[model samples]
Target: MANIEQSASAFLQSRRSVPAKMLGLPVPDRAALMPLLTAGLRVPDHGKLEPWRLLVLEKAAMTRLAALAVTRAGELGLDAEKAVKGSAQFETGNLAVVVISSPKPSDKIPLSEQVYSAGAVCLSLLNAALAAGWGANWLSGWPSHDREFLARGLGLHDTETVAGIIHIGTAQNSPPDRPRPDVAARVEWVSA
Candidate 1:
């Protein structure tokens, strides 16, 4: 196989999301994170709206978010068990990047298109972290959907919302591969 083709194929085949709970410390520092962040920005954006923003949360911020999650859960009348589970990420996270879907006012581009750009940014960041030898997982729990949690914890504007919360750290263990979708069954070929 050609060098480029072989490497790309191998990487795509081996890519997997390590569980956030299984991830440990030693996450990328600001100096080390620049390249990865740059790579993440290489995504499709119609109208150049760039309808997204990244919020990096280190240990202190993570701790604060976790506490806030629990408090917000109670105020929302969420079940105790679920509330605790939702707050676990904030308490345990070594590092995280919250992708905020901050859609812009665009007459040409639809709102859905702007939202998809944000989603793409999330995936791009996740992939960049994984490629840089970090254990990365894209996650969204009850707190992400809570308006009070987002506003109070992250200072997100009313127009902005969580697209994804990407957790990054060292890998404690490699999870076994799960079943994949049957592409052949899902695909349809069109003929003129």
Candidate 2:
């Protein structure tokens, strides 16, 4: 087999999240986005229950969501500055994938596990976009948590919730590296 480990390790080591605000167009066309979506579906799925769904928000959809954010913000009694910040992402982005965690009814698999699977899907989608030379950021602002926004904006069911909103587009500028967690301090070796 080819030496895939080296390339994978290098890619993981160099990977960084580009902020959504720093991302610009042209967003990946369906042809390019398909492979990323395929990769996202390849994550660890216990019981083979894909407890997640992706909603691609293009220009018009984003605009509608942005408008909803503004109205919802007012209804939620948020201040102007915070409301603007909440909707700014939708107002600007060319494309974004909203990962919805939709847990399925199961006896063998617990709901927590299903939730984790959804989270894994989010990370996988983000990484897939990054690996494909697109700037990707996983974000969830106040609007994502607002029930009114969820219902009116995205039509998310009560059992379903936003796992992440992954913005993917061309990067406006390269960001400087931020500090990483000290793994040694946080890790513990145990043998029993």
- Which has the greatest lDDT? 2
> After best superposition, candidate 1 residue 191: deviation in angstroms?
1.8
* lDDT by residue for model 2 (1-192), tens: 356888878899889999999999899999999999889878788999899999999999999999989998898899999999999999998899999999999999999999898889889999999999999999999999988799889999999999999999999999678999898999999998
Overall local distance difference test of candidate 1 = 0.90
Q: CA lDDT, every prediction?
A: 0.90, 0.92
Mind sharing the TM-score for model 1? Answer: 0.96
Best by TM-score: 2
lDDT of residue 88 for candidate 2: 96
Q: What are the per-residue Cα lDDT tens digits for candidate 1 across 25-125? A: 78889987888778877889999998999999999999999999989988989899999999998898899999999999989999999899989988999
Give the Å error, residue 130, model 1. 0.9
Error of 2 at 40 (Å): 1.0
Clashing pairs in model 1, backbone N/Cα/C closer than 3 A: none
